[model samples]
Target: MKKKFLMVFIVIVVVMTFFTPSYAKNTVEFPEEDSTELQYQDMIMLFLGSHIDQAISDHYSFYLKKDPIVYPYQIEVKKVKRINEFREFHFVIILEVTPVVGPHITVGKDKLIFEVSPTIPGKVKLLKFEHLETHELPPVWMHLLKKKPSL
Candidate 1:
């Protein structure tokens, strides 16, 4: 009985050790319009904008032989959350991509979350990019064609 009790106590200790939570804490904070917040916001926006431009170029480069333009609008910072030592920012951005001579344009609105370490500047990382809306406008000629067919 003495040996069995000792084994049980050892097993319980091992189990408790594995089940204990880590010391890291998570906190959520809203971003303000102060200089520091603005700097971080700009950094994240530039990073995300570059990514969006690259994605559009890679997919629609052929359509933009003349002049390619990408406009980012309606950027809003939703929330900021800190997990351990990293700060995560949640926001939404709307992008309009125009192929210089193409009749169809692509509009995309996406909500994204990015993580960065305040201790290590310039080490921004994207955690998530969720598309809220994405669609391509049909060319005017296509609409005319449909109208003629109906007539």
Candidate 2:
């Protein structure tokens, strides 16, 4: 009877483990309304969370593959400043981003220049994006993008 009970318990545990919902490790979190820079950072994080692997491969790989293998990456929002606010304004987002490799590679200092319109009824567009100078990346991150390039 004891052996039979143990077998049934093990089976139940296995079934529950297989049926449980697995949550993704990374998520995009943003405030409802904040500085333009914060909003831009949130948008970028959302974009990456959706297409992280593909984006990494497109930027780093030579061979094309259906699903590009990628590693865990993160971004630090260094600063957000508003230049001008009219119908639309240009805001600066200084960010530090890490890249991925067979083993995650730390890509050093990075920044993105964004043109954003204040929130509207339904949608927000990333009007323009440009890479900025890579300053000293923390030892954990390896810096790339030597100079600002229009994207």
Candidate 3:
């Protein structure tokens, strides 16, 4: 009787294994690259509360992966500020711009605050550029950043 019970248990195990559906073939696939576009907005924006520089560096790394640099820029996120609701992430960015046309050199440093869309993480609002400080900036950039920043 014990031998018959053991044989029945073994048969049941074999039947269950054969009937189970495989999930490996049905798993959803995601793109291989790490881009900010794929991350949760609040979680990524929440990062600005502490490490602003590192967060910006991580988010923009997708652009840095490109082999050739056109109108190259060395950008540093100096500050991340909160104003009003969670509608936007206010940032102070310092840039060293190298124009693709005339100068292939360190033009100068310009400190500015840019308002970016929180819903669409990387989109910068055109009318929101505010000049905070300026060093020996390029003539074109000097002209652009100098004005009232009103679009």
Candidate 4:
């Protein structure tokens, strides 16, 4: 009886261990600790990979006076660069404007490119554009683009 009980106990332990979730250890210190490089790469990937559309919208709002009522182009990041590992990067993105221009008229088709980097602790800014260019672009254009339009 003892041998049978012992065998079953061992089997149960082994099965439970196998079924246990093996999560990644949180040993990785903040990327900012050693070099802002990792953090920069992560930030770039997070921003570009996750928020390229928002970035574009931000650019338009910051530079132009209107936001596109339609998301015509399939925007993608072509290349990402990390400068000196201190959390700065140059992200090259490609926007392919589809022929369909919905509620908004298509302004002359032009590839929009801008240099963006971290300005605040966790916020990104367009390094080239300024805040108070009154006749240039409306600030709402910036806010509108950054947020995904409700489908």
Candidate 5:
């Protein structure tokens, strides 16, 4: 009986050893400076442009009766200034808005200054959107552009 029990224990030990998992440690390196800078710029532009489109859609949907087509042009990075430890970016973007049936109107251009966190690349928070040139829409259309309150 002792010999049989010893043989079974040895067999189990060998099987368990063969089934054990092995782990290899991997070290991840940070992205290269140029690549990271490109990514940051792309992300910033995309974020800002998307938000501006949404705002235009929301504010003018009543007059348009549908979402207005927005085209962004001449997007230039003006300055990258440091605000304390974080970097603030200033950009100038020209927006052209066209309603479905009406003539296309240009918002001229706008200067947007915003900051994004370096550590967390996923977060895009807008600090300010300053209008460089304001093109006033017709005041008669303003009444029609008022969005009805939702229940």
Candidate 6:
């Protein structure tokens, strides 16, 4: 009985800790730690990976099924600056994604901001996604895509 209970408890803890999503619907506060350029880039990529997995679409380009909205052929990076109360937050806004992938389109089309956390590189929040084009958020992301300010 003891062995069975311990095994069950360990399994539950492991699953909840490792398999669960890094972020929550509510606001999450990050610590005050200076992040390098590489760390910031990692955060962006990590956040993208998490969302890309959840994006809904039937459209496929070869084996990879392209998402309805988040197909990034070109990415325009804005200056990474800290914001909010703590000033540990950094944001990247992507205005366009094109085939040629040069000379960023500053004009408003479809834009989204990726807010990266300083505490955890993997943790990121997708905030304020305004679609100028026909792209859309997936069913799972509809509720999750809202901006979650720091608590």
Per-residue lDDT of candidate 2, residues 29-129 (tens digit):
43576788666656766644434433444443432222233332356666656656653454554444444322333332233333333453223333323
TM for every model, in the order presented, reads 0.37, 0.33, 0.27, 0.28, 0.37, 0.33
Query: Per-residue lDDT for 38-83 in model 5, tens only?
Result: 6665565576677666655655564455555444323555666655
Model 1: runs farther than 4 Å from truth?
1-48, 51-72, 85-106, 118-122, 141-151
| Per-residue lDDT of model 3, residues 1-151, tens digit only | 9999999999999999999753222112345876574453334334332333333333224333311122211333444556556744553333222111123322222333445455544544322223332223344433323232111
Scored by Cα lDDT, where does model 3 land? 0.37
Instruction: Give Cα distance to truth, residue 95, candidate 1, Å.
Output: 12
Candidate 1 per-residue lDDT, tens place, 33-106, comes to 45886777566557667665555454434333333335433355567665644335433333323322233243
lDDT of each: 0.47, 0.44, 0.37, 0.40, 0.48, 0.41
Q: Rank the candidates by TM-score, best first.
A: 5, 1, 6, 2, 4, 3
**Full-model lDDT, candidate 1:** 0.47
Q: Which residue pairs does candidate 1 place in steric collision?
A: none
Worst 10 residues of 6 by lDDT: 98-107
Question: Between the candidate structures 3 and 6, which one is better when assessed by TM-score?
Answer: 6
Q: Write the per-residue lDDT of candidate 6 for residues 39-136, one digit (tens) a residue.
A: 66456545575454332222112212223333332333444556665554654444332111112211113344666666545656555554344223
TM-score of 6: 0.33
Kindly give the stretch of ten consecutive residues in candidate 1 with the minimal lDDT sum. Answer: 142-151
lDDT of 2 at 49: 47
- Which prediction has the highest lDDT against the true structure? 5
- Candidate 2 residues lying further than 4 Å off, grouped into runs, are 1-44, 47-58, 62-73, 86-90, 107-110, 118-151
Better of 1 and 3 by TM-score: 1
